[model samples]
Target: MKAVVLERFGGPEELRPADVARPEPGPGQVRVAVRAAGVNPFDGKVRSGAMEAVFPTPLPAILGLEVAGVVDAVGADVTGVAVGDPVFGFADTGSYAEHALATTVARKPEGLSWEHAVTLPVAGETADRVLGLLDVRPGETLLVHGAAGAVGSIAVQVAVAAGVRVIGTAGPGNQEHVAALGATPTTYGEGLVERVRALAPEGVDAVFDVAGKGALPDSITLRGGTDRIVTIADNTAHELGVVFAAGPQQRSAERLAELADLAAQGTLRTTVAATFPLVEAAEAHRLSDSGHARGKVVLTV
Candidate 1:
């Protein structure tokens, strides 16, 4: 099988197209003929060795975090899906290839394109997990920092569906787009804290910061509670009384399935800002590293 393999950790250029042996699924896993793979900042971090202190990848690895594809075979103990089922799940690597192995998989949401399905496993699930941590309730106000990116976009839609009043921060270019997702869009800038305070005079019920800059405290100051603020980008932010949501303890197959259902029903959808063929995985990473992706970026296999 042809895959984008990285023998060493570095930039997107480290991802090289090579013919590698196809991997067979072990027990409790399944083989998928990947149709699309989602490129995320997580993938970029792993590639650049920035996450080496935390999550280190085996050398000569393929890099991708989630995928949309069809099942070609199921391993022993796999029963939720069968061969030929269209499924989507989180794999994190090897998804940039034509085939992938998944320990857990769920059906793609009905009425969703494969490109959109690829965006959900990681970003969607992360948003769901963080929102769950915040325990947002109907009529409560929720604010999401970095509202225009993959996780934030889905977070806004999900919060709105749960009946929470949503306010999200984005650059001026994305202000109108986030607003269309049922959130009052605020621009993140010099007076960000003041802007948020002005909007939610009573303070927001919860604040989700995907930007990861230890910025949760600013939002928390407005909300007046550390418990109400969560950050997915910074793992160490938890020490500051902020919550982190993507480790083994937080990611779950059940939560990912729920987010998929929401996407299928049109209650949630991701904006794919750009797409590249699998062969162009390097270019995809370069674009994502810009930190200005309007939505999820996908690699078609």
Candidate 2:
């Protein structure tokens, strides 16, 4: 199998294309003939050794979190899914390769493209998890920072579908895009507090901080406290008494299936900012690390 392996954790340069041994599925796992792989900010952190304390990666490992591909083989104890099924979800092994292993996957809807399918696992799971943690109810206004971002955009749509009013913050150019996602769009930085307040005169019920560019303080001021505030990007969450959601907890094949269904039905959507070939994994990491990508970055096999 051709994979982009991280010989050392330092920079994107560490990721080099090499022909490594294809991974075989363990019990309750499946080996996928990867069609596309999702590049996330977490992959950049892992590549640069920033997440070593939390998610220690052995050197010379393949680095990817999610993939959309066809099941080539199924391991023991697996049920319902079988070989030849097209699937997408969290990869058990690295997905920046021609083949990867997956333990959590749902059948890919025929209507969904492989690139779009790959985007759902991480963003969908994260958005759904944070919404659950916030306990957002219909009629309440929810504020989402980085609303035009991959996870944030999905969060906005999901919240809107659940009948919650959403105030999404984005750059000036993305304000219309965020509004298109069914949220009241506002720009971050400088007058963000007043802008959000103007949109939600009744006040924000909860805050989902996806842009870690120092939005927590303002979020606190708007929500009147740290209650129901969650951040996936801000490391200062602990000091601010906000919940820092890290890693997966509620990710399941069933949940992924539901999300995939919504995406197939055109209710959920993700923006693919760029696509790179598998050999250009380094370039992909650079874009992901830049934090300026307006949508998901993907790698095609």
Candidate 3:
């Protein structure tokens, strides 16, 4: 199998394409013939050793977390899924390759391309968890920061579908795009607080910050407290009395299945901003580091 391996944590340059042994599924797992793997900000964070304390990976390891592909084989105890079934899921490790192993695989939504399916496992799952924490309801206003990014985009759609009025922050160029996702786009810049205030008048009911650009504390204060504020980007937000709701189940199979169904129904959009061949995983990471991707960056294997 061809995979991009990290010899050591540093920059995108550290990712190298090489021929490695294909991973086989162990008991309670299945092997996926990876079609596409989603590149996430966490990929960069882990590669650069920035998130070492939280998600330490062994050196020379493959580094993708989410993949969409076909099941080639299932290990003992795995049932309800069989060989040749198209599936998507979050793997423990090693998804940046031609084949990876997964313990919890869910059926991919019919009609979705592999590129689109790969985007759901991570970003969609995070959005689902945040929405659950906030308990966003119909007619209430929800505010999301980094609204044009992967997780924010899904959050917008999910919140809107649940009948919540949503206001999101993004660059001026993406205002219409975010608005189309059921959010009122507000500009995030020098005075984001003032900008959000101007748009929401009565104040927002919830805030989900993924930017970790120092906007969360103020965003929550504007919404009137720690209870309505939840952040995924900054794990330190936990100590600040805000919700830090990320877990392995943050990318659970059940949640990805639901997200895929929404996509099949045309109610969800897992926009693929761009794609690179599996060998160009380094380049994909570079694009992701730019911090302005409209949606996910995928590596097609």
Best by lDDT: 2
TM-score order of candidates, top first: 2, 3, 1
What TM-score goes with each of the models? 0.91, 0.97, 0.94
lDDT of 1 by residue, 1-301 (tens): 9899989988889888999988898888889999999999888888999988878788988888787899997789988789999988877347989999887678886688888887777776677678888999999999888889998898888889889999898888999999988999998757878988888888888888876655666776787677678787866675677766664245567777787787778777678979999999999999988878888999998
Each prediction's RMSD over C-alphas, in Å, is 2.2, 1.1, 1.7
- Of candidates 3 and 1, the better by lDDT: 3
Measured with C-alpha atoms, the lDDT of residue 175 in candidate 3 is: 90
Candidate 1's C-alpha runs over 4 A off are 235-241, 248-258
lDDT of each: 0.83, 0.91, 0.85
Question: Which candidate would rank higher by lDDT, 1 or 2?
Answer: 2
Residue-wise C-alpha lDDT for candidate 2, range 119-203, written one tens digit per residue: 8888998989999999999999899999988889999999999999999988888988998999989889988888887888889
Strongest candidate by TM-score: 2
Q: Write the per-residue lDDT of candidate 3 for residues 55-125, one digit (tens) a residue.
A: 77878889888888999988899988899999998876578999999987689877888999888888877
